[model samples]
Target: MRRAFVQAILALFLVEAHPAFAEGPLHVDITQGVASPLLLAIPDISSGAIPEVANGEDAGVALAKVVRADLGSTGFYRFVSVDGHYAAADEVAFAPFARAGAQALVVGRVRLVGNNVLAYDCALYDVFGAHLETSQRILVAAPQWRRAAHKCADMVFAFTTGDPGHFDTRLLVVGQDGERPGLHTRLLSMDYDGANQTVLSQGQELVAMPRYAPGSRKIVFLSFVMLVPQLVLADLDSGQITALKIPPGVPSAPRFSPDGRSIIFSLARDGVADILVIDLQTGGVRQLTNTAGSNTSPGYSPDGAFVVFESDRSGDPQLYVMASDGSGQKRISFGAGAHASPMWSPRGDLIAFTLVENRRLRIGVMKPDGSKERILSDGERDEDPSWAPSGRALMFQRTAAGKALPGVWMTDLSGKLESRINIDPSASEPAWSGRRP
Candidate 1:
């Protein structure tokens, strides 16, 4: 068997906070300048004690692919496709990476353990001769063997940048399957790669805007059971469902406050549309916005004391922020017409929203103080921007030529679209969970 021991007590957990591996601020102007992304070169294990998942598949291929995929999705790191000179691992020099315009390289060795157990040892090097970083040995149980390779990839990501790691998290989305027109709506949750998709709900009715609770073990969404939209909460472990205490008519966009004690949503009360907040324990509803115009698409701040919502009080749909008690209301958006669907970043520093620019819609993020606005994407219609749990990546719905086509597109803080992560067309309103932050 492999060595069974604990050193520094940090090896027992998958992640440990260290300033030596933090993601610092990027000083470049993200709104205007479109610059080149840093090139990344990821090589496979050189031999030794390989991870357990490397038994059947090529160790180098499996580990290298994982690292490539994780880094590629960030929209920041570009993987360099170097074909030749991989055979001569020992004689590999810095010229190839330099010629390919690569800035960083990750190399590792996989040590094979007895029977079912394995260990992984990896090292990250800065091609510009800036720094050389290493990782502790990765010991894995047989069932969780694949996670060992993912751990090494995560360490490489944290070392190269000064931000918290997000490669090990999961994504829950609403996948629409079946033929056109008469389609079937079922809830699909999967890993970040769209694999291991598990159906959460299946039926004839429609489900929209599935959001993960603060802790991520539970989910809250809007469901139309009998032509009435009700706020429903489901537990992932027990598959049990509970109906929230909401009034009659349609109540959509259910978002949990920062403290997770109350939920703010939009209700079509009587005839006019308004935003309301419900106390989780007492089921008491407090109307937040009483504007005569339609009010919808509500979000909460990270501190649980303030909220940012959308309304047409300014003669056009725009974003607004207010206290938890519905006092001291202030406007945060000054963009062109139809600036709705504002989702507050969990980091409490930025807000991601949608706007109409040049008769087309695009996704953008700005400071909560209404400054430094930058559009990240452009299309015929791109609306409903959702933030990743880490607040580093933003996912939204995209439509071209107006056919009700919706696909998920992710981008980083620097406005780079890494991978398209496409799903079946007609998928819309994606909200990533807030757990892994």
Candidate 2:
């Protein structure tokens, strides 16, 4: 289940008038795209041996599985199984798949290199008439073979959609133990595929919602280190800490604006919460939402023009949209549930949030305009979804069955889940960082 989750979150996204998006120029425009899922075939790339065996699961075969996993996880591609297709890239007959409902073919090869390096070659073919789209060669260490496979998938995705791939990014969050006398929350970071797990903050005061600055070595999170619930920034490498707040109110849900110049969050005081933005350069504070109900979870659109947030003004908390300068207020979430935690994906195609359905909490994604709602994680209780820089995977906190303990879980929009780890103390609420660049 965990492996499946990781694969799904590793890929996911399209959509509409996002004020945050600049009208200037698009990084990658996928306005028109093929609805049919891409069809791909990966054969056996046999090596001499594995770390322990001569060959590691047949080079081509293994690489195919990884590519399949990555593409299928996106819910945008339908990879043909090796059981029904020819096993060699050279023998690939595009006629059958293009006729059998496949749009594109992903092919690749891998070779072993002593104990330190592995060489890889990958290609994308327009299976409709068997035309090679593009191809590339990459070199990596033995341990980076899987990563190389992901890169291959990234290349295919970028080539087909004309958008940057997010398979190579990472995610960070707060993890908690299920059983503990007192509150136990810590900061946790891991690769997008659940590799290189590390603890950023031990069970020090509670830490909630950690986000990365654009291409920086620092991470900003809402931490109650002094029990004040202020926005704190921690340098991962140097352990340097910088905090921002006006005293009192818990300045929760800190998120970096698209340009990484400011952070927007909710400042709760006198039992009333409102949206506010902090200027990183001047430490200036400006309020965004001036509604009656408490507004929290303010997220900047990919283009940094609009801010989508949650407000209870209508009696139930629902998704609301407003200009970055706090104008043109409109409600989007009309679903039959109170919606909270609106997160804008870096890709600008979708916004991930937690939806409470049938009295059960689940992680779901929807078009930026609040259409085509799909739940990704529908379980006992799942809330606070944070999207990776790629807008592919979503990291959230889930309580164990019949237990209040919350651990971090990630899933792609298609419902694939990665591994679930039980933290030493109860934990909940997570916000992922944006891409380094």
The local distance difference test score of each candidate is 0.67, 0.67
Q: Write the per-residue lDDT of candidate 1 for residues 1-437, one digit (tens) a residue.
A: 00111111112223323335624221112233335555778765444224445466766567667767776776656677565534314645666776776677776555455565555555565666645544545665533444555566667665655444566555666666654422677666655555434567765787777777786557788887787777988777666778898777678888887777778888886766778998887889898877777778888888777888888876888888888788887988886666778888877778999987667888989888778888888677787888875577787877666565566667777765635665654466676765332
The TM-scores of all predictions, comma-separated, are: 0.80, 0.76
lDDT of 1 at 177: 62
Model 2 lDDT, residue 231, Cα: 85
Can you give the lDDT of residue 266 in candidate 1? 88
lDDT of 1 at 60: 53
lDDT of 2 by residue, 1-437 (tens): 01122221211111111212222211123353334454555544444354522245665567667677666656556556443533334465666656665556666766655566666677666666566666766566655566667777777766665555666555676666546423676676665555545677766687767788775356788777566677887766556678875545768878888787888888887878999998988888898877676999899898999999999999888898899999998999998888888888888888888887677888888888999887888678888887766666777888766875677776765675454633344445655544432
Q: How close is candidate 1 to the true structure, as a TM-score?
A: 0.80
Model 1 ranges off by over 4 Å? 1-39, 46-56, 78-103, 108-122, 127-153, 179-182, 281-284, 357-359, 402-404, 414-418, 424-426, 435-437
Please identify model 2 stretches exceeding 4 Å from their true place: 1-35, 50-64, 81-105, 111-117, 127-131, 180-183, 215-217, 237-239, 245-248, 366-377, 388-395, 407-437
* RMSD each, Å: 6.1, 7.6
